[model samples]
Structure formats: C-alpha cells, structure tokens
Target: MGDPTAEANRGLAVGPFAHDGVWLRCALHCHTTQSDGMLSPAMLRRYYSMGHFDVLAITDHDQLTPAPDAHSEDDDLLLLPGTEISLRSPESGGPLHVLGLGVNAMPRVPERATLLETAAAVQAEGGLAFVAHPWWTGLRSDELGDLAGVTGIEVYNAGCEVEQGRGDSAQYWDTLLSQGLPMLAIATDDHHYPGFDAFQGWTMVRAATRTPEAVLAALAAGHAYSSNGPDIHGIWIEADRIRVASSPAVAISLLGAPPRGVRVNAGPHGLKQPGDVPRGADGRRNGAYPGNLLTEATFPLLTGSPYLRVEVLDAHGRKAWSNPIWLPARG
Candidate 1:
C-alpha cells in the first residue's frame, strides 16, 4: 500500500512498513485436555513456553479454558484466552472452526447455523475471529466471499498437515484476497498432541509487550506473520520496489493469484533445483526438494497487482508468510 493509514483501513498494517513493535512468537490456536488435545492446561503452558513461544492462546473447542498458573511470576510467556467454535458451514456442508482470541466469554450468534454471523458475533464480543483451516474444512474460496468480520485465516494448520496432509491453505487465502478482500493469514500449530503435532506452525505477532491485550491488539492490527520455520525480519515497500529480510531462504517470492508476482531465487538462471535439494541427500529424497536459501532480497512491485504478500521458502520446505499488502488502486 502506498499510504500506511489507507493500508490499515484495508487490513494491511502487519508488515514492517513504518511499523513499531517487537516481534513475539505466538501460538494463537491450540487445544488442551479441556478439549481433544492430549496436554493438560499446566503442561500446555510449559510446552509452548519451552518451545520458545512468547504467547499462547488456550483455544479449546467452544470453551474458554483458563491458563494454568505459571510456575514463575517472572516468566514472560503471555497466555491469552480463546476458544475454537465449531460452526456449521452450510455452503461447504462441513463444520468450520472459528478461533476467538482475547475474549473471556463466547459470543452470542443470532443465527448459530451461519459461520459469518457467528464470526461477527465473536468480534462484537471484542475478540479477534479467524477462519481456522479452510482447506482442512474443505471450504471453497467463493464461500469466504460472503463471510465477514474475520481477522484472518489459519493459512497453515500443523495438526491438519500432520494428520491428513491437507494443512497448507495459501491458495485458499489467496483466493479470498483475489476477490478484493483484505484477508489476513496466520499459521498455527493447532497442536493437539504435544510432541507430534505441536510446534509445527506458528504466528509471529509484533506487539509492544508480552501481554494478552497487546498481542491480540497486534493481531487485530494485522501486525504479524505466519511461519512453519523461518523468520521474517522486515518488509518495506517504496514506490515500485519491495524489500524483504529474513532468515536464510532458498527463494523469496512476492505471491498473488497467478502470474502477477515475482520470485528471487538464490541461484542464478534458476540454478536452484526445483526445491534446492541435493541429489541423493537426506532432504526430500522421495518428495520434491523444498528450495534454496538467501537472507535478503529486493524486487520491483508490479503495477495492477491486486495483492502482494511475501513467502520465504527455507531449505526444508518450511516457510514464513507475510500478510498481504494490498496495493492501492492503479490509476
């Protein structure tokens, strides 16, 4: 976006374009024994904090579970209150999981049968609502066109991926964005089992402090990036140029619907193998290699670009994704 205020109006405030905040590693969605998760409340907290997470939202299904008492008063780990509501998505004929973060109580939905209205109700209760795992729910992009009041979608769901291999929802998020919606994207572990599915996906929220309010405020303000592994340092856009800095990656790409984006590969002449993996190496031996690694890059932002978001592919196929920065209308 050309202007920060205008971009914020369109839900484009997450990037490092004049943004001020410390990045907090946040696991916005997960469960505990309060739901189907294998961990108890106390153990869940230690698990996430031990995993290096600064914030955890205990989002058990349809119920707000109080975070267990922290063992140390000096611990900086912030535990946010949340719940995962299972709403029926009539369009998709499946249950939609909607996450309500930073709310103490459940929202009242006028029509419990409708996902959109339920999401709005959650927002009315002062919670940031997001569509969780659209791909896992088998939702179509057009279905989200009619949905509103959602802060974002869980673009990568670790549980969904580990369980059935249908975790990546970048395409679903892009479809909604292509429809002219400012759809924020966040990756979450959706951890149910502690060691297996936990810690696979996470969102890095930029906030002033490691508190529930600050973290949720940053999330609502779109100040975050989703990741499976790599970290995003900064994203700055000037004129037609966009620059990105992050952990070493094989390629940094500006992604949109189709041919409207750019990719900067680490090797010259696309020298990088499709996934940048070496032959007969332990990496992706039977599957496609992930990609190569470079720490930083800058590229020209294309005009008429509907939406541009950064995607960094690490050597292990893990990725860090920035929320879309919707460009102002082309004149």
Candidate 2:
C-alpha cells in the first residue's frame, strides 16, 4: 500500500502554495452528490477557486467520492475523492459516519457495518479515516478505540456549532488530549450551500500544494494549523512547550486560562495563548472558548503539559478552528 503522508507531500511542487515554504489551505470535508449536498462538484470547484481555497474533498454520504471528475480546474484549484461511509449503530442502527480521504477506490462498509469493520476497510485503503460529528450524532468521538489504524477526529464542526459561530466538536478532542492521544483536531463546514459558507472551518496545512495528498500529509505528520479565519502560518512546539503564530500584523490572545494561561505573541498571525480547556456549565463548550481574535496576546510556553494546540478565529467570529500543535506522543 502507498503511504498517505508521502503521497500528500509529493504534490507540493505544483503551485505558489509551494512558493517559499508557505502552508497551503484547504477544506478536508464537505459533501456533494455521490450523496446529499445541494452544490454539485462543479459549482463547489468554481467557488473554491474564487474563494482562494487550494483543495477540497467531496465526502458524500454512503458513497465513494471522485467529486464529479467533471469540474474543470481554473488554475489553482483541486478536487479530491473521498466518501463518508455511513456506519450504523448496532443499538438502534442509526448513522455513524466515517470520512475517508485520498483513497483510490471504495472498500465496502455495509450500512450496517460496525464502526470497527468500516474503519478497517478505510485503513486498508491507505486513507485517513476520521470519526466525524460524533457529538451531533449522539455518539462519542472516542469510540474509535474499538478499531485500529484510525487517524484524526473532528473536534469541531462549524455546521453543528451554529450558536455563536464556533463548533462544540473540539471539546471531544480536547478531552481525548487530556488523556494523551495524537488525535488530530479539525474544523469542518459540513457545508451544503454557497449560503452555508459559515460552516467552512478548516486547517492551513504545511504542504506543497492543495491536493488530497498534501492535506493528508500535513494532517498525519502534525504539520497542520487550524483556522476559522486569520491564517495560522506556522507553530512552535517543544515537548510540553507550545507557541502559535499567525499571519504577520495580527493580534493574538489565549482564552479560558485559570489553571491555564492565554498568551499572545507576534509572528505568524501575530499572537499565541494557552488556556485550561474549559467545560461548559452543562459541561459542553457551545461557545468559542479561549476567546476569539487569535492575534492578540503575549504568552509563555508550558514545557511540562502533555498536550497543546491553538484556536484561530476571525474578528467577525464567522470562521475559526483549533489544530493540534503539540501532543506528548507526537511532540
């Protein structure tokens, strides 16, 4: 089988996204027909190019994605194949969807297939399979433990986080980090419309170009930074140590620091912060924690903590995300 990280990195030679070590940006998950999305792959490709997105995956429901091999590339845009295998719960047989990116063909995961069986097929394909939107689906994201060779978890889903423009999904991953797993956190739009751009949370990956391979490589090797807006240019990590930066000339602040501290600095996106992961009153962070305006703070790196990452949000609170920057195992 091919290495997903190596495949993802090879495409770096393709564009300006490759110019001078800048990270390429992309949306890893989204839908189209091959399943139930309002926008066709062609329409999505048009919008992605105009919006300056480097790449995207069309992970349709219960079907494999080649995303309409029909859309013409207008220059810097790329469409990758993916599929959201709709695994059903054994208890009530409800949906337990898993996303498979960068696969060459579909491996069968019957609708009634257990999550573990489905994940096996996905891993077998040499693709990265993530448990998507578990909080929304009434399942815990951590349930992937029953399976082997799983990668990534949607800690936040912007579409599910409709309240104050932040997704509750990150909490699930944060909880996992507290226990020390290299659970790659991400923000997804799960978008279905041009109108639903609000769901478009993503990661700025250190990749050669915006391709399925680049995104996966950035994701696997822990080289990605997340964002709703205000790009996360690069990150600094050392053991329990952590430092985050964004596009130059921006302010940075860390939010929710009591046992935790929020710090800010200048460089990429111009800021950084650290905070004790907050638990909501009902024990759910339905709001943007660690505060918004990622480019506004001065902070220190905690060299003993077992985990760390930064949340990047735009000033409007419209788009944002958290990417895992440090994990005890991976760091």
Candidate 3:
C-alpha cells in the first residue's frame, strides 16, 4: 500500500487499498446450523451482533445457506454468501477444505472428477475459491493445482496448528506469484463450533468501505492480510515505500515491520481479561491481563525501501499478519 489516500488520487483503482474511515470488518469464513454447526443462521447473527462483526459469510458444507434469507436480526452487519467443500473424502486420501468467497449463485459440479473438480465448480459459479488447510495433517494432496482459475489460497487457518496453503497450497501459490499470477492469500477460522469462533485465524483486508463490494474488491486485488489478531487499515504503497495505520485502541508493534526493523507501541488491550473472562478465538485464558491489548499502531515509511510486510501480535501471543507489500520496484 503507499497511502490509500494518495493512491486514491492517482486513480489507479488497483489493490484493496481504502481509507474512508469506519473500521472495515469482515469474517470470510463461518458455518451455520444448516450443516454440522451448533446454531442456525438466525442464532449465528446473535453471536456476531454481540461480538460486533461488520460482515459475515455463512459457508456450510457443500451448500450456500442463502444469507439474508436466514436473517433474524436487523443490524448494520452485512451477510455475505459462501460454502465449503472437502475436495476429497476421508476414504480417498484427500480432505482439504475449499471455501467459496462471495458466491453470487450456487454452482453445481457435473460429476465428481476429484477434489480438483470441486474447486473448479465454485469458480464456475462466479465465486472465488481457496484451498483450506491444504497441508492440514491427513488432508494433504499432490493435486494442489488440479483446480483451474482459482483466486487464491488460505495461507493461515486458526483452526489448524500447522495446516493449510502455507504448506502445500502455498508452494502452489508461490509458484503462481513468482510468475506474476496475481493470486490471493487468505486466513480463516473454518470455525466448527461457536466456542472456537476466534480460534485459529483470520485476514484483515484494506478496503474503501465495509461494504460487500469492498470485500470482493479487496480479496480480488490481494489487498489483504492474515492474522490470529490485529486490524490493519490505510495500507499504501508507492515509490519504494509502504506505510500503515492500525486501530487507535490497541497498542501495536511490528514484531518485524517490513524492511527488517520492528516498531512497538504501548496501549490498553481491546477485550476483557481477568475474572471469568470468556476467550475469543484462541483457547488460552485472558489471564490477569487488563483486556485485549489489540490497540492500534502506526508506522511511517522510514527506511525508504521498496517492499515489506506488517505483523501485529497481541499480549497473549495471538497476532495479525499482512500480505507482503511491494513498494514500487522502480520509482
């Protein structure tokens, strides 16, 4: 990113860069009672409402749950459409999860050619597809590139200790990226239970607004980052330099900011910590800490380098990650 505002004036219309204010929020992967989940879409809204998520995608097993159709609450939260597919079954030596992002209409497969076909079907439906947990333990497969016209891969998943595109799917993505394939990387929770809501991971996308259009644009342009925690905003890239600003609340630091240096800021956490505090996402107890120390942090383009990434870690070890930022290679 350089300065979303600066790029905004250049009129390039590239990247998911955006800066117009409200915290852009979205949870790209979620399941409903329509599948193996414990609650219905209606109940799920309650959870999002209480947690204050801006948008959500209800991805059930092999099906689109027709969000807004399942709406029971009247809030500003946007309900995005989606679904999940286990490319191969437990019996066939394949079990990777593929998520369909921003599906406009449900697409069906002609026949079960294999996991490759599963991913292709989603793309055919005018939706973007991703390999979930590509290296998810027993779900590994050599058919990583079997699917055609894929949009991206899940580099990190909160539900897995060390699974997903980062392993196999990532190698495939890297091969594609090295060739300037313009592929995207995403983070998801693949949340099966409500208790595991924040467990695993998520992605922070830079968008012009918190609208559905912005979500699709961000994911499409690869202007996104993954994380267990942290929020990134106003990512701008220009003239061999990248700058970023996170929320104003949490104290954030670049455990390793781009260009190989680190930036740290001290502030209060975002959520409750002590007492019978219920954890969000991670299984660890908040402990005696005050609250979620996810306060925002900002770093300027200090090194005048061409490219780098950002990572924000919470006091509890949970953290958020941004995709690599390639400042203009030749300014």
Q: Which candidate tops TM-score? A: 1
Worst lDDT run of 10 residues, candidate 1, spans 278-287
After superposition, the stretches of candidate 2 with alpha carbons farther than 4 Å from their true spots are 1-22, 69-73, 89-94, 141-144, 163-166, 209-211, 237-242, 247-298, 318-322, 327-331
On lDDT, the stronger of 1 and 2 is 1
Clashes of each: 6, 30, 23
Between candidates 2 and 3, which one is better according to TM-score?
2
What are the runs in model 3 whose C-alpha is more than 4 Å off?
A: 1-15, 18-22, 68-74, 89-92, 114-116, 137-142, 146-148, 162-181, 234-308, 326-331
For 53-115, candidate 2 gives per-residue lDDT tens digits of: 777777888677555553544556666677888776555445677888776788677555776
Q: What is the TM-score of each candidate against the true structure?
A: 0.86, 0.72, 0.66
lDDT of 1 at 124: 78
Candidate with the larger TM-score of 1 and 2: 1
**Candidate lDDT (C-alpha), each:** 0.76, 0.56, 0.57
- Worst lDDT run of 10 residues, candidate 3, spans 277-286
Q: Write the per-residue lDDT of candidate 1 for residues 1-331, one digit (tens) a residue.
A: 1222132322222364457667788888888998899999998998888888889999999888987888676566888888998877667678788898887577776555476787777887789889999999998776654567878899999999999999999988887888778888889999898778988999888786757888888888788889999977667665556667667677777777665777766654343444442221111111233434466566666666688898988778898899888777664
